[model samples]
Target: MTSTQETTRPRDIGGSPGHWRRMRMWATAHAVDDFYQGLVPAAVPYFVLERHFGYVEASGLALAATLGGALPQVPIGLLADRHRLRWMSPLGISLAGIGAGLSGLVPAYPLVFALLLTAGVGIAMFHPPAGRDARRAAGGSATAMSYFAAGGSVGFFVGPALATPALDTLGIGATALFIPPAVLMGLVLLRHHDRTPGATAEKVRRHGTDQPGRFAALTSVEIVRSTISTGVNTFISLYWIRHLGAGSGLGGTALTLELGGGVLGTLLGGRLADRIGMVRTVQLGNAAMLPALWLMLACDDKYAALPLALLVGLISNIPFAVLIKLGQDYLPSRPGTAAGVTLGLAMSAGGLFMPLLGVVAGHYGPRGALTVLATVPVIAILLSTALREPVHEPEPPRATPSTTHDRHR
Candidate 1:
């Protein structure tokens, strides 16, 4: 490429402190999307009975909260690729907050569901752009996305914890109280929206123009793996609770432990992939899951279940960061779309298969259902056919300490 071409290409520069800060900011803006939806599964049934609404309507409300937030991810992702995502993140949060804040204010059924659907739209809009930015902000590493993804897990945990208390303190009618903090953050985002030197903007713009073919290639396989992973998680929760005689509290504990494991696994896995290679890290994580499968299937003790579940979660999520990073490497031009589709759509598509899982569960019982999900990692091991090591040559062999000029960068 010529000098003009080198200057024109948008190279990734996400490893710097400035980029991590941006990732954190995007994380906070998108937290609102996680908070309420996570709260919905617990609240939706209550909304039906307490309000004397029909079960179908309440279930519809629940589905809207979930799939609505996930369904439109790709379209929004593509748009954010072309524009600054600053306002989009905040606006989506504010809209969801408005819907959630007003959720308890109304007495009518139609309006309540309508507002939730609206809330769902906001979440859908918010995630793709913000997630894409996280992929970019991660500065081309799996560890970066780990930090970014952990924020959502934390937000989800907070949602139910906060909502349960808020219900008692403010009552459902006063849920609007939750909106203030989010709104204030949106305002702050507007004020702090990046207005850096044109050179920095020029660099980011150039990075956005990298190879699209690579991104789509990784995205295709990631979509399949992600879908399988989501199915596994959703079923595990249901099977353990219903058939294993685990209580709601235990189920929550299991899920949280799994999430915490995922956070750690992602961090370690990404760094390992960086040191070794993506395929190695991916294979190691998936293969490590085999023992966790034994524990999950055989262990009946509640305490035993928790730690095993945690290990399972770790193995499940370890591959995630690598997939997101690879997607960006493949499709240099649309990192956000790459991350959003796999994380959002592939995940949702996975959950969408729960009905089939339910059928299998009915035939073999809950234990059998969980076994089905545990089997999916085996498929992931097989589907990893497309994976290849990143093209960057391994760092050269080190010389003697006295002779080597060890510059870390």
Candidate 2:
């Protein structure tokens, strides 16, 4: 399959607009499924404490969810490349819903971790398919994938907020857990009925522009730097609660501030890209983290931690939107693989680094961890320097009749 064919303006199944609209619906459905998988960490501690698991065991459950959810992106990307997105996306959503519902019902600690792992696998399955389908519908621009990624963030916020209240009041059997995925799957199937066909091989693009070779190393750099910054932000929230004696309300406020910053970043970063280019925007986003991290690290007062957490959240999330957009341009033909690797594999790296982070916290405390995380933006700044700006072909100018006559004369 030609690479150009792979990117040919996305046409509807019937060669119309309705197909793109319908596909967006499925993209959203699958994104929410991914969101819940991301949310398990925020809710699992309560589950563990309420269920009588020790702190270590509870942390284990949380860790399992990320590991399972994150590690399978490469295989899933290949599968999505090889197959149809419609069925794969819905099936993944259904599995994630089932996993969330079942996690609450299981009796053993190991069983709970297993449910979380299954939930992660479901998340891994959904993203590549949803992303690829969205690209197909949205006309293969960075804007398309950015919008697609935003849905996952919405899910991430909703999952924790929705689950916390339910589990707090109703001991994990809350039917709401099952409702999200089931409703989404049913909705997608109803909307996209009888339209899903097995994916045919796309003609590979003959142009050298389609393949990203050394760019993989650059993507790896992005993965590590983003993951490290995120891990530090997670640590900051806990640090505030512990060291500053901040209540849950204050910690939640800090988290909210971070999320709000992400919304702002997503909205504005694209314009920044158009004006200054992808490289400058990425550098600015990462550089913004330095002062934000410094503020959090210097604050020893109780009142200061909330704003510090807010700062960390703000700086950490903006770059998130930027990096995902950059990932696709780095590998335009395999945006799905890029999503899986940058968002998937690198997240596991973030998870893998936690043990060392924990030691940093244990020996030097959370403030030291923040300091370490502060270095990530510096690293990202360096990594982004190596990226070549993606070449975008400009539209041709219209020819004037007067010019034609002059040339003929």
Candidate closest to the true structure, highest lDDT: 1
Error of 2 at 283 (Å): 2.0
Cα lDDT tens digits for candidate 1, 70-160: 7777888777777666787777777777777787788888888888877777777777666655654554555556566666656666777
Model 2: ten consecutive residues of lowest lDDT:
199-208
lDDT of 2 by residue, 149-230 (tens): 5566667656676677777788766623664665567467545635643222231111115437535655766676656655
What TM-score does each of the candidates earn? 0.81, 0.81
RMSD of 1: 7.9
Residue 388 error, candidate 2, Å: 1.2
> Cα RMSDs of all predictions?
7.9, 8.0
